[model samples]
Target: MTRLVVVGAGLMGEAIFSGLLASGWAPADIVVSDARAERRAELSERYGVGSGEAVDAVADAQTVLLAVKPADVGGVLEEIGDRLAPDALLLSVCAGVALATLQAGVREGTPVVRAMPNTPARVGEAITAVSPGTHATDDHLAEVTEILGAVGRVITVAEKYQDSVTAVSGSGPAYVFLVAEAMIEGGVHVGLPRDVATELAVQTLFGSATLLRDTGDHPAILRENVTSPGGTTAAALRRLEDHGVRAAFLAAVEAARDRSLELG
Candidate 1:
């Protein structure tokens, strides 16, 4: 009986809505809004859910999801400022839009939860971090977590740390992709065929992630386990160190965190 409304049926919004319905929530229990007429029509029929404009979908919903792009978020909030159900919880999936900004635009005392979810969420393997606004409560947190938990793990972080979350995991997928690209190129450099190189690199990345998750061991320890003295991994690691990969990653994450703050 949880009536949910999602604004913006774009990639991330669609992914979350699909994840919820696939997790056994009834299709009729949800609704979505998109500025594009074709998108609204397509998604509603495809998901067997309701669809309409942002101002129209929150009619009696328990939660209204703000999934608009960061750039458009303010305008959408301002547009619906007078119409949003006063008591319905507002859940934002737009990155870099701070809780204060959302709260200021919404009715005073309307509960708001700010969340940072990554690209992997599309495949149902995201790790999301949430931060509560002033009017949000324990019940609100649980509800937001349930919504996000459908697609992946959820963690509570202080609002102050949300920007860092944006840096680390929100933008983390690009970092992993870059690593995969480099690994594939490294394999090609070592004379392997493209398909074989891709397979090796991808499976290795997947297996390494699985190992960390399955064993619950420290990643550094796991790396140590594979890094025998003067072994292949050690040689490659040494080369990576010489190329300053670790330093570059640190600098990149820091830069992203700063940019997130600027956007907020």
Candidate 2:
């Protein structure tokens, strides 16, 4: 039997496949499916994995990864619902779509695991959150975690917390990029060359993140460490606070959470 079938050849799909390969899974053990023949051909050439129609791909597989767009998920599930092996595990990465929705589309009692992964998965640096459906067992959740861990960190959360997870991490990268963009522009406004500003902004973000991760320090403590009394960092931070930057972030995350709930 095929060990895994990834039912989409898009960015995240490709990333997960690549990560699995990097983590020592044989290409022959996996199959990928895409609606576009060209996409299937490209993935086959790029990864040397088997490619075919979605239903055919999952027919004998032990695990089926549903990576299609949220709008397309229902149709894909309907196509493969009856064909999926009775014991196959269904793992979904469709954003905003709930486990209830996935459970409704698949065979009754199918063990569905809903995952929210960010764009950074493309680089194998993503943090994915997995929430189990009513039928999913601890072992099933563990299996999904192991599969996603091939790419980056994987955290298990209750389904209720998934919307907040979607907001905080699923949409988190764009927030970081916006900050990086503003920092780069700010550096340019202060007379730095654009290229130099870009490097500075990028490295600063990278280094700060590394520091926080490596040292296991609270972000506030880390921020305080760099902020001297009446210093340049202090002045900048004061301006950000005066402009309600912190509150804005809070509001933005809440809005994203609300939107995620609406999507579900």
Best by lDDT: 2
Global lDDT of model 1: 0.91
As a TM-score, model 2 comes out at 0.97
Find the 10 residues in a row with the least total lDDT in model 1.
52-61
- lDDT for 247 in candidate 2 is 100
Task: Name the runs in model 1 displaced over 4 angstroms.
Answer: none
lDDT of 1 by residue, 65-123 (tens): 99999999879987876677778999999999998899998899899999999988888
Please, what is the whole-model Cα lDDT of each candidate in the order they appear? Answer: 0.91, 0.92
Residue 65 lDDT, candidate 2, scale 0-100: 93
lDDT of 2 by residue, 1-264 (tens): 998999988999999989999999999999999999999998889889988988788989999999998889889888998898999999999989998889998889789999999888887889999999988999998889889999999998888999999999999999999999999999999999999999999999999988999999999999999999999999999999999999999999999999999888
**Candidate 2: lDDT of 53?**
88
In model 2, pairs of residues that clash are none
